[model samples]
Target: MGYTIDPTIIRDRFARSTNEQLIDIAENEIRSLTPEALEFLLDELRKRNIETSQIAELEKKVTRQHNKNVSRAHSALAQDLSKEGMKLAVKMKLENASNSDIQEALQNTGISSEESLRIIGSLGEKAAAMNKTGNKNLRYGVIMLLLGCLRFFIIQSKDDLNETIILLLVLSGILFSIIGLKIKSDAKKISEILEQESLEAQ
Candidate 1:
């Protein structure tokens, strides 16, 4: 059952509504309004000395707008849920979760089974690519750090040590390490968010 508004409240609202506002509702929103609301609105118009014949014609033009409005509302809601499901799915996938686990987690959020599967399917390749990139960055960062350290040590043992080179090497190593670790840290944060959302959903 839909929500029911008090008749008194409805009457008060209509009583206070301007002619423009009232006519706007009758012309554009009459079809979507509750029956009781329409009844109150018509009564208000009658008290305003509006002709019954004009009201009758306005009622006839109720058209298909209400169905269109309902369709758009449902579409918008589905899109929002789909976006939420995709975010959860990506986080779980990054954490190396199974498809079934992601699907279940999505269902727990009120997403339908078909939508959950579609989300999983769409994200599969993208998630794998992200993992690959993150791992690559991490590996490269470690190599850069180690190479810089080795070079620093070798230069230290030499009589003609280049301070400029050593400084550049150390700075580059720190930069790369920070970048790589930042990516990994971001992934870890996403996983933590997924857990939190999952618990909240439950």
Candidate 2:
């Protein structure tokens, strides 16, 4: 029995064709054919010992190639964004973004080959804004720590015996300060990693 061109298979192969291939086919092969004539031609091709399986395999090959291109594009885009993010983070002195935040930013930027290069180019400003927000949060935490210490002093001045409160305040300040410095160091390390990754992607 001759093979039948299943409607589903036809649709799948058509979808699999690249834009350039589709344009070429439309312009050169099908330009003069009416809709009915095109259908007749396809039906004739289907009956002349062509296997749908071969068509499916060809479609899969095209799809694989397209996916590879997309993967490469995303890698390049991620690298660029990572570099940009690190530079802005350093400039803003925002040395304390969580790993989750860093990952999310990379994922949301949506860098891929199919998109125009200009779209990826616009993300530098956005990265700077995100880094600035991170810096502001870090500064706020520091201010809150200082204010807490000030409040402890006010209470101590009002009370006659406040040794425990004073000691707690001093120790807490020292601990928090150390933590803040460590956070700064961690951010620096992470930023360096990001820059390296960006370079590798290129």
Candidate 3:
């Protein structure tokens, strides 16, 4: 009845993250003795100005990335196990199952719904605690992408008399910008969380 830290678990955390979050994790958790690292980490997070919701998005992304990595590693391990004549049950029961699987198992086993809710709620609260700053970059990035698309469309339409194509391009750009901002916003939030944790630890 003992526990172990799976390197794959750590790798899964990385795989589920944006480059920024991965960097933050490295700065905060994996690295030590980097001069004034905690203070610098917090300052960097402050400069980024991420928000709680965005941070939640980051956590989701990291979780997702972590899951993907887990899946890949699990699959690889399964193949190795197969070569060694290990049973499927053994493979499936590994610690690297997806978070969804973990949650589903907890729910299916009649773990109280309230308890599950509390766990989920706590995760959100953790993210909020990590990043107090709201995400300005997310707002600005979206606006800029939209404007870029609009400008590109107007220029093209006037040059080629293709109003329909111009409109479509503008719409596409706006949509892409909105989506990109949302993704980046999540990454920003994740970075903030890592930074906050790093600062506190120091």
Candidate 4:
């Protein structure tokens, strides 16, 4: 879905975020940023006059935190749905069944109303989580692209003993961009699988 967010709003939000919050975003939640939002983050860092070396260090500290969170969420979701339950749910979703119909179908299988409701709620939650993860991956991909470009410039400006560090940064950035795109694609697929009309609204 195409959308737009004001750059000033993004900048203001970043401006209000504390240094620790910014670092946390950089290290743990980079994937959650939009490309424009990530640019604003970089602008905020520049406004603070944070050194390139420090930025590089922050990049090095980045980990698979988002992956870990997604893994745990998926594990919980799996435990909530048996093979038969999952199949039934997917079938209903594919059939464009109403929330009430799906609920009734689930309850017909000896599941309680409460359990059926919980299952539906879990599906919504998982879809939302996957969507959020996809957004983050896109943001992280932008970050990688920006950092790779920056390193390429640095490599041209001066001869330094840190060639190995520069090479690693560039290579890792490329690798991350590729991986982020793949993760974003998977997240989109997961969202599609879990998408449904709101039961509450019905």
Candidates in order, TM-scores: namely 0.46, 0.27, 0.27, 0.34
> On residues 1-202, what C-alpha lDDT tens digit does candidate 4 reach at each position?
1113787877887799887777777766666655556656666766665667886666443334334546666777655664456457645755556667878988788666887777766655554564566567667656766765777676575556455556665676667667666655654554564443433445
Give every collision pair in model 2: none
What's the lDDT for all of these models?
0.71, 0.50, 0.46, 0.63
lDDT of 1 at 110: 93
Q: Write the per-residue lDDT of candidate 1 for residues 103-134, one digit (tens) a residue.
A: 99999999999999999877745444555667
TM-score of 1: 0.46
Q: Ten residues in a row with the worst lDDT in model 4?
A: 60-69
Overall local distance difference test of candidate 4:
0.63
Better of 3 and 4 by lDDT: 4
Q: What's the lDDT of the predicted structure labeled candidate 3?
A: 0.46
Q: 36-127 in candidate 3: lDDT tens per residue?
A: 33233333344454676654554454445445656766777655633332222112223333334544554554444554444433443443
97-117: candidate 2 lDDT, tens digit per residue: 433454445445553333323
In model 3, pairs of residues that clash are 12-66, 16-65, 16-66, 50-133
